[model samples]
Target: MTQAAIQVRDLCFQWPTGASVLQFCSLDVPKGEFWMLLGTNGSGKSTLLRLLAGLLQPQSGEIKISGQVGFVFQNPDHQLVMPTVGADVAFGLVEEKLSLAQIQARVHEALTAVNLQLLQRRPIYALSGGQKQRIAIAGAIARQCEILLLDEPTALLDPDTQLDLVAQVRNLVKSRGLTALWVTHRFDELNYCDGAFLLEQGRVVDRGAPEHLKQRLMQ
Candidate 1:
């Protein structure tokens, strides 16, 4: 639809030990829309995101992604490399060949967008789980990413904080016109997505209204 921001067509991937991870799986995430992928453990959900992010190579099929891509992991500790929040966020821009002033502006804008400007100078270890997620997302924004891929970003947060992080991501998608595809198993999180895809056995068996998928999974 409207030239998807993230397009996966007939993707196929397998491990070196002859274990199939994904097979003929395909999906399209329209530009500026927020979508979620739901699947049980070992359904290849995280593997698919990694493929789209170019972290893994596919055995077959094609993946077309428009604009810069930003990836957020389930654990912030896996990606945040800098000691301070601002440094971590700014770390993403190291290869951009930007001047100090330009990098500072980007860091400020990104932190402000995530409502983390006040904690920009705080040590990374001093932040809470939710704040850590915000910092990770801010790092993506600092790079001016147009497409965001998140792998169960709320997995470590409390119930309320989980919802808060999802809501915050939804706001970022709408406000910044960024396309986001998030991987999640939590049914309640479906309420925030424009659509949802149900993956089973490494393939998409259901895709449509989030509520419909949520209800089907419940029943």
Candidate 2:
């Protein structure tokens, strides 16, 4: 069996209002796999991602992630802070204390991995929605995160752009051997996922291959 990149055992969480938001007996994301998390609004998809990213702590049980996490929000505007593509990608590395040359190399490599090296100097405000998404991904790549936590990243994109963004993410994941937990409500997007889990009221109700889940859901 493949080693688990992320493991959650008996995890539980609640809002400040004391209302439970998530309760998972166990969950696993295998190394180098693309897993889609499907649910409607208030299903706790975003909350789960936050927990995995260490933005929130579980009230009970254990959560184990093997390596660093890079999070991408649904809106690119929320993730981006710098004025230009290159600067934005480098922003995450500034605190690493690496030499200037090392930072530049990493930024260049990350941009190239996303096929956006040419646009490194482009202004963030001038980018198309799809391009901004790519830039956001490049920042994650630059961080060299072992696992990526994406919270409904394609929610704001057009259908065609959404598909393109998924393809780009698929290529990058395969080449980098990174584990990704992506949250989305679009059933069609499951075509890009290796497997998927259905979340209902903060509980995992179903798990299987993406095609199998899609067929079952349709039926």
User: Per-candidate RMSD vs. true structure?
Assistant: 0.7, 1.0
Best by TM-score: 1
User: Which stretch of 10 consecutive residues in model 2 shows the poorest summed lDDT?
Assistant: 21-30
Name the runs in model 1 displaced over 4 angstroms. none
Tens-place lDDT per residue, model 1, 1-219, is 377998899999999999998989999999999999999999999999999999999999999999999999999999899999999998999999999999999999999999999998999999999999999999999999999999999999999999999999999999999999999999899999999998898889999988799789989
Candidate 2 RMSD to the correct structure: 1.0
| lDDT score of residue 168 within candidate 2 | 80
- For residues 1-219, what per-residue lDDT tens digits would candidate 2 score against the true structure? 999998888788999999998886467889999898987799888988998888899889788899889898999998899999999999999879899999999999999988899998999999988889888888888988878888899999999999998878887778899999899989889999989888887678888899888987889
lDDT for each of the candidates? Answer: 0.94, 0.88
Instruction: Report model 1's TM-score to 2 decimal places.
Output: 0.98
